[model samples]
Target chain A: MRPPLIQLQGLTRTYGRGDAAVSALRGIDLTLFSGDFLAVMGASGSGKSTLMNILGCLDTPSGGHYGFESIAVETLNQTQRALLRRHRLGFVFQGFNLLARTSARENVELPLLYRGLPAARRRQAALAALDLVGLSDRAGHTPAELSGGQQQRVAIARAIVTDPAVLLADEPTGNLDTARSHAIMELLTRLNRERGLTIIMVTHEEEMAAYAGRTLHLRDGLIDRDSAEPDATSCC
Target chain B: MLLNALLLALREIRRNLLRSLLTVLGIVIGVAAVITLVTLGNGATLMVKQQISALGSNLVVMRPGQRLGPGHDEAGAPAFRREDADAIAAEIRGVASVAPVVSSTVTLVAGAANWSSSVTGTTNAYFAAGNWTLAQGRLFSDDEEQAGKAVCVIGQTVRAKLFAGEAPLGNTLRVRAFGCEVIGVLAAKGQGAMGMDQDDTVLMPLATAQRRLTNSRAVGTVMISLKDGVSASTAIADITALMRERRRLTTAQENNFSLMDTRQIAETLSGTIGTMTTLLGAVAAVSLLVGGIGIMNIMLVSVTERTREIGIRLAIGATGREVLTQFLTEAVALSACGGLAGIGLALLACLGLAAALNMPFLFNPGINGLAFGVSAGIGVIFGYMPARRAAALDPIEALRRE
Candidate 1:
């Protein structure tokens, strides 16, 4: 009976103008309730990344309405959108963009730093987040010193440190091997199932998409198919 | 937010320690040059003023020249006579003493030591006019001066050269054509304002020197000392009028003598030196500006190099202003560190220079503080462009950059 956490109606995104204009997103209509684990699958240039960018509040749609918990996302200015991203949305990139020279602990503390939390509290929360991602013993290691799987774990720790409303992962295992990729996917599924965290992931792997409760397939910036399980509420 | 930005900036600086040091070197040299020049210049000005004052406070020299600067036509000017000196001493109310001098370079012999020295012919009032003190023995008596007695006062240089550590009070030293008894030893006055050796001269009565050495009644210069609480300008005006009247010069004719105030000369010289210092300081400030440009250049390169990092921060919810503050803070810290190092280097250099030049090491806190403030300002001014550039970068585009 609860309202959807995110609702997108006729969403559209275009780059440039006139003859040079490239329409990245034609129109997308989607809805997802709280605690939902959704996977967005598309080939390169299929606009899945564009859609995820909009969902993360990192980019705005050229046309359409996006509402997060009844707040109009399109009406917010740059600072308001930044605040939305800071307090509500978290992102994990494919490249695992951890600060190169910084330790994993400090990397995780970054979000709390932006929140203006005190140093001591930020440290405790960052350590707890690292523990959650199973990277507690590797807190002192930098990105260069850690393996790809461990680095991705640190990135995931950074994302969840602020306890945001949703975690947005874009090809979170793109750079890892099959074994590490399965491990990371299992970690994400565990976090979703155990903690009931809302996660929207962009991945092309069918196996990765299978782990989510629902799957949305995009073809040429339009939703080709939506596979929502009949008993999604029962799983939650 | 500020504390976080500062810590980030410090960490980034430490990350690129070599580049940061190179960027700061420009500022260091600029600030050090400015401070050293200013401090040394101040000390030199003080030294010159002191030497000029040592000539005598409230003293004036009248020379027989119609022009002020060098290469003047002194041939047509009438020299002062003994009566002219006496008349000015009697007529001028503020006059303390007047000594009319005639000087000649002569070789003097004492035992096996023969040295070239200046022989000055003057009255007993020469000591008062010159503010000279006697280290030992008394000045020639009034009776001796009136009688043109062959008695002389020897300065410290002449004493050291001719006396050679032995007592010279009753010793006889040969002048140009006659022998004279050394009645007194003048205390040392070191070097004069014009770098002349003040203690390499001998003094005797004007009449005595005129008869024995030159046989000329014309005095080359007249030294006048003013009494305490008397203004030099007023005394000069009175003496000028008295000299004109005594010389029988009409209103249509120009006076043949030039009056020089030691205080005015000191002020003009010091003013010139002060202007030169400012000029040097300005030139040195240019280096600071260059240093600032270096910072901006390095910062721009850094912003470009860290595009991905900036994108990460932006995606993590850092505002453009926050990014600006971080980069600006880094630039300012770089320049401020350079400023501090420059100040230290300047102090060390100034101490060494002061010792080498035999001048006092003068600390000017105002200049030091100004240099520091300006160098920091350089950071803000030059760093803005790069910081703004970094802040303006699109997060998506930046993130895509390798």
Candidate 2:
């Protein structure tokens, strides 16, 4: 009876036009409910990244209906979409796209700054966000001064600072070593379990995919497989 | 929001410090050079004007050729004499004082130093008519004028050359083999409004100068002073009528002599200098425009370099307006800083040059303020394009950029 946090029906995305037209997604249907962890795995050019871009509201679907919390994305303007992304969606990326010169706390405070919060409250919220990602001690350090894993954690803090409804990660561990990757995954797992946050992630690694509660495989822009992760790994 | 944007802008600029400085270099030079040039131009103008003001704001000059057109029997008419001075004073209601001067160049000798100098023969009215002050001794008296006393008053330049830093007062300086005691020394008057030396003359009784120095009784010019609140037109008309009647001019004939103000010469000089300053300022102003273009060029490059950064800020919840304001603020800050630097440099240049030349130094506050404000404006105008581009970029495309 409860509505899904994200709904997609009959999604199609085509790039270019006419002779050069290529369908990146074809007739896709998906629903992501609250407290769900979904990992999409695909080879290169499998349209997984394109789907992620669409799902994250970074790109518009060529033909589809997408509702986030029952609100249609198609109705939102660019600014409104950005506002929606700011207030509701969090992002984690393999590259850890942190602002080059800013300290970690300032970086986390950026979202609140956009919210037009006063300086003091921004500081408190940013500190809380940093504490959530266990980057409290390094809050004053710039991205360049931090390690790759630490920088990613800072990026996560920035994302989670607004208390967004959904967390989207694209190849979140692609750039990290196996140990660092596992550590990041464990952190994400705790956030999901303790906060009941919805997460949609993309990766090609089976081990990383195995950490998710369920998985979907994309091949040539179409869904190929959808299954629950093995019981042994799901609880962990 | 503005403060947040400012913090980010400052941080971004800090991240690429060298490049940002290099980019703003043209603006810096342009602003500084403009302020310096404008300040110097205004100072030079003021220097001339100050000389004018020192001559006394109320003083009026009467030159024969400058007023009436030359030609006719009166063209070579003898200069106005003492009788004319008496008539102007007695008949013209506004006439406060009047003096006749007979001037001629003569060779003078004092010790081993000999220099050609101007010798002026003037009445006691010369002091009040020209608004002169003594630096050392006394001006010629009425008895001295009536008796054609051989005493002379020396100017600072004349004393400098004749006496060589020693006080020339009470000393005799020879003119044409006749020695006249320097009873007084006029204060250092520097250059007049017309850029002519006002301190190279020796003054004596008009009768003494004509009878002894030049061997002629013909006068050279008339100097007139007016009472406060009297219109120059009223004094001019009265003098013209009295002089014409004195000269016995026919009713149809215009007066031959020029009765003018000291300010006319200043007006003429100032007009000339103003034109020259405008021309020079135009050349300097072109550099400001070039500097603006330089800002635009650098800002465009910045927008490109920070495309992804702009996207990040947008994604972080900054409105397009906020991004726009940030870029604009950065531009303005660059310009404002450049303007302040320019003013400092201009002041320094002015001080150094003014000291070196020993010229009258004047730094006009108005010009300095205008130069500073314009420099800042140049930043805003030129930096607008790049800032708009940065603010207008699509968040998705920006974030998607590699």
Candidate 3:
């Protein structure tokens, strides 16, 4: 009976103008409830990243309705959208975009810094997040000093430092080897199961998607299938 | 937010230390040049004024030439006589004293030492009109001047050259054709405003020089002193009228004498120094502007180089304004540090130059502070465009730059 965490109705996005225009997303209607773990899978140019961008408030829909909780997100100004990201949304990038020379602890504290948290509280929260990702011992190490998997863990810690409402990850484990990728998926599954945190991830690997409770596949700017149904591949 | 941005800026600067220093070198040179030039110029002006004041306050010189500069035909001009000086001393209301001076350069021999020095002949009142003081021994008495005695006062340079370590007073020194007794030693006055050595002279009574050395009654120049609080213009008018009548000049005839006020000379010299300082300061300020442009150029390149980092910050929740403030803060910090280094460099240069030139070190707080403030302002002015460009970048597009 509670409202969904995110709702997208007839979402559409276009790249350019007139004859040169390329449609990246077309009429994406979806609802993500609280505590849901959803995986989005698609070939290249299938608008999975575009949907993630809109959901994270990093991009606006050209024509559609997007609601976050009870507020209409498409009508929010730039400042409001930035505030939404600051307070509610966390992001994990494919490249583990940690500031180059900064230590792991300082990198994790960035979100709280933007939120203007007190230094003491920011340090405490960042340390706790690092502890959660098992990177507390590597707090003083920079990204160059850490392994690929360790760096991704630090990025995850940074993403969750503010305890955001939802974690939006774009290929969070795409750059890892098979063993490291499995370990990251296991961590995500544990975080979802133990903390009841909502997560939406974009990945091309079916093995990574298998960790999610539900999966959606996109083709040519439209959702081709939803794995929640029994015969989803037949429909596609 | 400011503290966060400042911390980040400092980190960035530290990471690119060599590049940052190179970027601010222009500002350093510009600020240093301006401060050094202005400080030395002011010191020179002050020295000129002080030398002029040393010639005596409210003093005027009457020379018998129509032209003022060097190479004028003084041979054809009528020279001033002792009667003209006596007439001004007796007739003018604000006149304090008058002394007729006749100077000639001659070689003086004292035992083994011989030196060329200027010998000036005037009465005891010349010491009062010209503010000359004796370092030792007494000045010549009125009886000595009336009787045309061969007694003189030697300046410090003459004493150093001829007497060396011996006592100069009551010593006999040969002047041109005859020997004169040194009755007193004048105090050291260093150098004159025109770079002449002031202490290389000998002073004697006017009657002695007129009767023995030159055998002429015409005086070279007449020095006038005015009473306290009396204007020089009033004294000049009075003396000009008296001189015309004394010389029998009709109404239509042009006056053959020229009057020079010490105050006017000081003003003119100081004005010239001030104009030169301004011109040099302007040139230095242009270098400052060039330095500012260098900062802008570096900042633009930095923004482009860090586009992906900017995108990362934006994606992590930093507002465009926050990113803009960070970049601007970096620029301002760079220029301000450059300004501070420039001030240090300028102070060192000024100290060395002042010592070398034998001028006092004058610190003008106004110009130093203004230079510092302008450098910081230059940072803001030049940094704005690049910061705006960085802030205006689209997050997705920036992230895609790799």
Candidate 4:
């Protein structure tokens, strides 16, 4: 019913040149709509990280057509891509990359700070984002003072503080215990259902992928399977 | 964005305060050295010029030697007599006054106080020629000087040592075989051109000194002062010609005398001081440059250590330019703080040293401001490369670093 928010065609990423070249992604063709919750799974060398990096605009594909909301992403320059990320994309790293020794509130305010928002509004929005992640009470606590799960929550708050169109997460619960991993997944699920936020996650855990509306498995840099059947033309 | 960068820089500095302090120590020392040396050097130069001028800019001294420097062979030269002084006073057109002088070191006893001091013999005209002003009492009278009366004018230091707060005027001072009455006390002149105390001697008439101290009629020096609007070179030529003719020196014979211009001495001494100041300033500036290199080295290390943080910022949409600005701001901030600290330290050091060395405390705003500006400029010059490195880092690769 809705147009696709992201479209990728013939995406290929290769590291190095000539004899030492290693192809991280052979080719990938996919279309994702707004509010879609997708999980990507693969083995260690299956290029899941490379694909996520390309999707996050942190790396450019060797050859590809990447369209974000009908705009060609591959044609954008580095500064343009950074601007795209600043205004429309959000990211959560596997390491929960919160600045060490910084409070959760300031961490959340970072995006707004980059956006050049006024201090008063940055503070209000950061507080609101922290509250959404259920971390309002620990907003003043630094990463070292917080638990792993709480740190992940703060990272999520930082990611969503700018209200970006898509949230790309790389193994968001990789370092958490079982109960904490489940708790983070439940929080993601709640954010998806209540706020209708679009999320693309990379994980190897089956249970974590089970929470997403769709799952794609990769083997040897190619899609092994797609859990949901497409209603449009399919390549595989 | 700049505000954010500044805050980040300040926070980073505060995080490792000790390391930050150590990193800027080179800059602090460099700036402090420059300011202190220049300030003291300037003070010394001013003191020298003042002391030289105090000897009277228009005055010249005639000594019986080929030159005024070391190893001068004045042994064969004839000493000047008081008649030569009288001849110059009468024959020289521009001569305002002339006083024949002879000096000898003698120990004098006044009450319980005893001091070893140089006793100078000259006419009352010596007061005007040497720019000596009376702080109390009166100068030698015509009758006193002509009769070679035993009346002396004590210098301030001599009064302090020999009189000890007691009224020196009309008091008798023992000088060799004769007892001279103190008729006046000269005003204090702190230090002379050669760092010697000027106010540590006694003055008497030419005849009195020759009779009581030297036991000879030889005048060791002839001080001549020129009238206002008179050319020193012209007057010197006239005086040299007259002296040479009186001594019956032919054109083939070298004049067996030297002339000392107070203004010339001032110029030579000031030039020497200026050269020394420049040399020391250059050395200090090298330290400043080395300090800049130190900043660059530390900044490079900082960029390496904060690679992950840079990656995080980049991933969250920070542009390369923003990252560059952040690192540059940190460097500039660190160096600027060092500059301020150096200025404060130099102020204290200059004050203490000026007092200890008995030099004036001369505060030079231009040098202080220039030092600060240069130190900050060093930040920009040395910070650029490391900042560019930080900005050029690939987000993916940087994040991959452990």
Counted clashes in each candidate structure: 1, 2, 0, 0
Residue-wise lDDT of candidate 4 within B1-402, one digit each (tens)?
Answer: 788788888888899799889988888988999999999999988889889888887998899979774466688899999999999999999888998999999998888888999999999889999999999999999898888999999999999999987999999999876889999999997778888889999999998999878989999999999998888888889999999999999999998998867887777787888889879988998888998899999999999998998999899999999989999999998888888898999999999999999998899999999999988999888999999999999999999888
Can you write out model 1's per-residue Cα lDDT over A105-193, one digit (the tens) per residue? Answer: 99999989999999999999999999998989999999999999999999999988898889999999999999999999999998888
Per residue, candidate 1 scores C-alpha lDDT tens digits across B106-209 of 99999889999999999878899898999998888888888888999999999999888799999999997799999999999999876889999999988888
Task: List, residue by residue over B1-402, the lDDT tens digit for candidate 2.
Answer: 667666766766677778777666665666667666665666677777788778766666665543432232346655666777777888889778888888889999988899888999988788887778999899888788888888999888898888987878788889886889889999888887656899999999999988897777777778888888888777887787878888888998866777767566566676777788777777777877787777688778878988887888876666677778888888777667667776777778878877776555676788778877887788789878888899889876888787
Candidate 3: give the clashing pairs: none
For every model in order, the fraction of real contacts preserved is 0.55, 0.47, 0.55, 0.62
Where is model 3 chain A poorest over a 10-residue stretch in terms of lDDT? A227-236
Lowest summed lDDT across 10 adjacent residues in model 4 chain A is found at A227-236
lDDT of 2 by residue, A1-236 (tens): 88889888988899999999999999778888899999999998999998998888877889989888978997777777777887888888777888887899988888888888899999999999899989899999999999988998998888888898988898999999999899888888888999988889999999998888889898999887778524423546
Best by DockQ: 1
The Cα error of candidate 3 at residue B233, in Å, is: 4.8
Give the local distance difference test score of model 2. 0.81
Please provide, for model 3 over B197-295, each residue's C-alpha lDDT reduced to its tens digit, 9 standing for 90 to 100: 999999999989888777899899999988889899988888889888888889998788878778977887888899999999999999999999999
Model 1 sits at an interface RMSD, in angstroms, of 0.8
Identify the CAPRI category of the predicted complex in candidate 2: acceptable
Task: Please tell me which model should have the higher TM-score, number 1 or number 4.
Answer: 1
TM-score of chain B of 3: 0.89
- Candidate 4: where are CA atoms >4 Å away? A1-3, A228-236, B61-95, B106-115, B135-138, B141-151, B159-184, B207-221, B226-264, B281-290
TM-score of chain A of 3: 0.96
